[model samples]
Target: MPHPNFILLYVDNPQQSAKFYAPLLDKQPMESSPGFVMFALDSGMMLGLWSKHTVEPAAPKIPLGGSGELAFAVADAAAVKALYAEWQQRGLQILQQPVSMDFGFTFTAVDPDGHRLRVFAPYDPAL
Candidate 1:
């Protein structure tokens, strides 16, 4: 099976979500339309935002949050803390503060459409 290289998030408004994510991800939408927007990430992964109402087959009626999270992995605990501070200044709705869990140092924030965004540093037993 092929590895998934694209991730799509169902959003209330693609334009609004694109605006919110563009600067944060430091990438402009490679494609945009009334109901859809797409960004190409540095890792060759594609992130797409599609209007919830317009998605074919229809999306299930799930709340905007607590379904799943898009996680970004960073280098270390300090990087996690640094980003937490920066995101705080930018007013991302923080759901979890920086803390060390069994997996690593991590935190969770939410986008305007209530999609969970997580930043973490993988656990390194050494250092």
Candidate 2:
């Protein structure tokens, strides 16, 4: 069976998106070109930046990946708060401040292209 792995985020400018994510992700792009950029995440996942206008064959006219959220889970609520503060200081647009929720504590931010990035830490200490 095929498994999911890569995440391709359609961006207006691959180079600019790569630059924006580099510091936040704390890794440089493993591959970059006028139309595309790729990064290797610590979890062995691949994140690709593809030009919004250039996906071949069945490419949508509008940029993709803006509607879905990219989530990061942490050890606990404190970690969630820490990341929220850090990202806020880093100037990512904050969509939601850290708050208690059924799942635990979570905060959301938006990337340059308006894609949601969410960080959460479960209330259950065992997790």
Candidate 3:
């Protein structure tokens, strides 16, 4: 089976979404157009922003978030807290504050298009 290396998020405007993500991801789009934008992550994965109105197969009209989340794993709880503060300072809509969960120390924020962005430090029994 082929490994998955890409993720696409439907957005109202790919250009606008790119603007919102560029600073947060600290990367520029390797590919960009009116209806699509693509960013290359350090992990070799790719993130794509596709215009909801222009997707070929027609995406469902349901709400944008809550269906899933794009999660970023950090080294420790302190890192999660730092990122949470940074994102908050950048004006992201914070949905959850830093808290310990069964999985880790985490927080949730939303993009302008309502895509959930989760930052977490995986629970480490060794720590």
Which lDDT values do the candidates have, in the order given?
A: 0.95, 0.86, 0.94
Query: Could you tell me which residue pairs clash in candidate 3?
Result: none
lDDT of 3 by residue, 1-127 (tens): 9999999999999999999999999999999999999999999999999999999999988776739899999999989989988998999999998999999999999999999999999998886
Residue pairs in collision within model 2: none
Give the TM-score of each candidate. Answer: 0.95, 0.90, 0.96
lDDT of 3 at 111: 96
Q: How big is the positional error of residue 1 in model 2, measured in Å on the Cα after superposition?
A: 0.6
lDDT of model 3 at position 78: 88
> 1 or 2, which is superior by lDDT?
1
Candidate ranking under TM-score, highest first, comes to 3, 1, 2
* TM-score (C-alpha, index-matched) for candidate 1: 0.95
User: Where does candidate 2 have its weakest 10-residue lDDT segment?
Assistant: 57-66
lDDT tens readout by residue for model 2, 48-79: 98887787764655544446888888998888
